[model samples]
Target chain A: MHEYSVVRSLLRQVQEIARSNGGGAIETIRLAIGEFSGVECTLVELAFRDLAPEKIGRQAKLEIQNIPLEAKCENCQQNIIITNYQFCCPRCNSQQVRITAGDELTIIDIELREVGVNA
Target chain B: MNQTITVNRDLKADLKEQANRFRQRMSDQGTLVVNLVSSPGAGKTSLLQRTATKIGDEYRLAVLVGDLATDRDAERLKPYVPVQQLTTGGACHLEIPLVESGYERLNQSDLDILFIENVGNLVCPASHDLGEYLRVTLLSVTEGDDKPGKYPKMFRTSQAMVITKSDLLPYVPFDVSSAVEDARRIQPELDFLTTSSQTLAGVDEWCEFLVRQLRKIQK
Candidate 1:
């Protein structure tokens, strides 16, 4: 799976952010993963577990939020929660639906312990 | 002390931006980049072989073929066009960096078209954009008609779907219309074309499609 590579990118971004914020010990990484993002949450967590300990520390945890596939119909302007990967609008049966959300892997926020805070 | 940092960012945003920049650069050079993706053995190289024979004389074309290992595809298209192979070394997808390096190796800036034959996997390739002007997904007749519905992400992200191995349609259970219908459900404006590189059927139409895309970019 490509989740390992994706996690590597995620860790790189996290490391950059941590470094910019005074080189703290990363504690929690918050992420939002969409249903249609072509990523498996379990696989991502597995990859994170395998790769994060050495880079981000052993206690760092991933908090993942699963986002459902949602779209807006261009014809009738009806908001829809897509089911079974059907992209057609349910209200108007319009095929001209545009995805409003649920197609991304976003890093929402992160919690870090400031370096030398306990020192 | 514990501190929280709000860093709202899409993971792929940087990659997408890079792809867009590449697209603009290629557009300025009058190069139509076509990313061809499909399952392994879905006639990607075969179609390219036919495409090279059909339009290689009319256009300055090059190919960057991605595979886990092996330069066999590049060898297949060598007689027809300038070809480079980007071996991912086990990666399931061809990312932007790989595409850029492959393009540099091709070393032809005045190309009319650059075709990237992506690594043969429908899933991961759909997630990574290779700065292509046109993203075409190929479905061989032997792969069944229900693939569009099953692999929704791949079909949804693609602009066009090429039904390959049309010569084997009678032998296989693939219903072209049903596959098109299913794909169109996810992508209403998706274009569809059927061809067989073996029989050379619809090869001219495919070449014309590329020509039309090139003209669009030129204008």
Candidate 2:
């Protein structure tokens, strides 16, 4: 699936972050995946399991947080959590709504062992 | 010591930035890039054939068709316009790099429109931005009307939905109004067009829409 490629990209970003911070051994990689981001979390974990060994070591664990779609209605000016993938505003039933959050695959943080530190 | 680093970065940010820059460059060059996405056999090639027949004389059009193996799509469109086929080998979707390389292969300037016909998969293609000014998703009548609700991300990310094979409506159970309603719930502002590439029905409106989009960017 495309999750393999996505994980590849994620690991590359993680590798950069780890390298910039003293090139530590990655322990945990936390990700925030929105419901509408077109990514499957389980597939991402599966891909990471298969690919992470060489990139971030075998012991590295993945932690993914599911984010609900959030949008702001332009006409009603109400913040709403979208359900059933509906993009309309709930309060005023206005179709003029803009997505404010929950549509991205974001790397929130990473836990790693410091390069010179003992295990 | 175990150290926690706060990165808070989107994985696709760099790729998206590159795509944005590419889109800006295309806009500056007066080329309207349209990314056509759909499931396999959803009439993307058929629609392109009709579009070329309808508007080829008026606009300079070229196409970059992505598929897993064959250059068949490119071959099909060559009679009407300049075309390049991107064979992904095993990749399910087209990325920015492939698109850029395809454009380079085309090597044509003074183009009015450049259509990137993405690999035929609804799920994966929606996640990748390929530097297009417009993203149009196609759904044929045979795919059923519930597709939009099931594939929310694909419908949500698209700017327009083209219901292809409209001539098959009588025999199929697909309802056009219900399909549009389902998609609109997810997209809210998505433009809708129905076309039967076989009979060339609604192809004129599709070309007109492209013309309007071109004018908008040119201004």
Candidate 3:
């Protein structure tokens, strides 16, 4: 799956950040993966486990947040919560609308063990 | 003591930061980045070969080809100018950081056009932002006309659509006009182009359009 590539980028970014922060080793990587982002969490975890250790983030723990899709109806301007990809107006059944949220894959922050502070 | 918790937030801020940095870098270097999306066997490589031959010397062109494995595309594109094949290593899509790195690897030169051939998938590739000036999605004549309507995101996100393998149009059931019309219904400003690598039909127009966009970025 594409999860392997996503993890590779995730690992690269996390390691860069960690390396930038005085070359400290990273212990955690937090990711916000939205439901509509089309990425499965279990697969991401599996990818991280397989790929992360080979890079600069050899011992990092992965943290993933699943975001739900949200959209607003164009006709009635109703804010509707969605679990899937369809963005339809509940009031008028209008398909003309925009996605408000839920499609995101990013590393928000990382936990690190300060250099020379730990064995 | 240890505890468990949930961290949640949409990456609005993160994406914004990435976008800002990307826009600044692209604008500073006058780089016209085009992310080419399509299904496997949609003739993206063939189209690139034709395009590079048409306008290779006139512009500072480079390509970042993505695939599950191999440097074959890069090797093929070498004689033209510069080509970097990014092996996704079993990944389906290219992300922003990788593109940024690819830019650096290209020596941050004054590129008139940078073609990023994304992994051949019509769905998820449309969702991720690769920081392109224009997004072009391709559908070959053999892939059926219903693809535009079926995968609305790819059509909606792209600024243009290319129907490749037009040489086979006579034998195929593809209705080029209807497919273009369908894409326009979903995205009003989406431009459509058709080409056949074998016959070299419509290839000039495609190169001209790309050259025009690259020139616009330069100005």
- What TM-score would chain A of each candidate receive against the reference chain A? 0.96, 0.93, 0.88
Best by TM-score: 1
How would you order the candidates by DockQ, starting with the best?
1, 2, 3
Best by DockQ: 1
Task: Give the lDDT of residue B177 in candidate 1.
Answer: 98
In angstroms, how far off is B187's CA in candidate 1? 0.8
CA shift of A100, model 1, Å: 1.2
Model 3, TM vs. native: 0.72
- Candidate 1 regions exceeding 4 Å error are none
Candidate 3 residues lying further than 4 Å off, grouped into runs, are: A4-35, A40-70, A73-96, A105-119, B1-6, B10-20, B184-186
Stronger candidate by lDDT (2 vs 3):
2
DockQ of predicted model 1: 0.86
Interface RMSD after interface superposition, model 3: 5.6
Ordering by TM-score: 1, 2, 3
Q: State each model's CA lDDT, in order.
A: 0.94, 0.92, 0.79
Error of 2 at B12 (Å): 0.8
lDDT of 2 by residue, B1-219 (tens): 699999899899988998999999999999999999999999999999999988999899999999999899999999988999999999999999889998998998688999999999988898899999999999999999989998888888899999999999999999999999999988888999999998888999999999999998888
User: What share of the reference contacts survives in each candidate?
Assistant: 0.94, 0.93, 0.12
> Tens digit of lDDT per residue, candidate 3, span A14-87?
66666677677777768888766767799999988898777854667887877777778778898887533444
lDDT for model 2, please.
Answer: 0.92
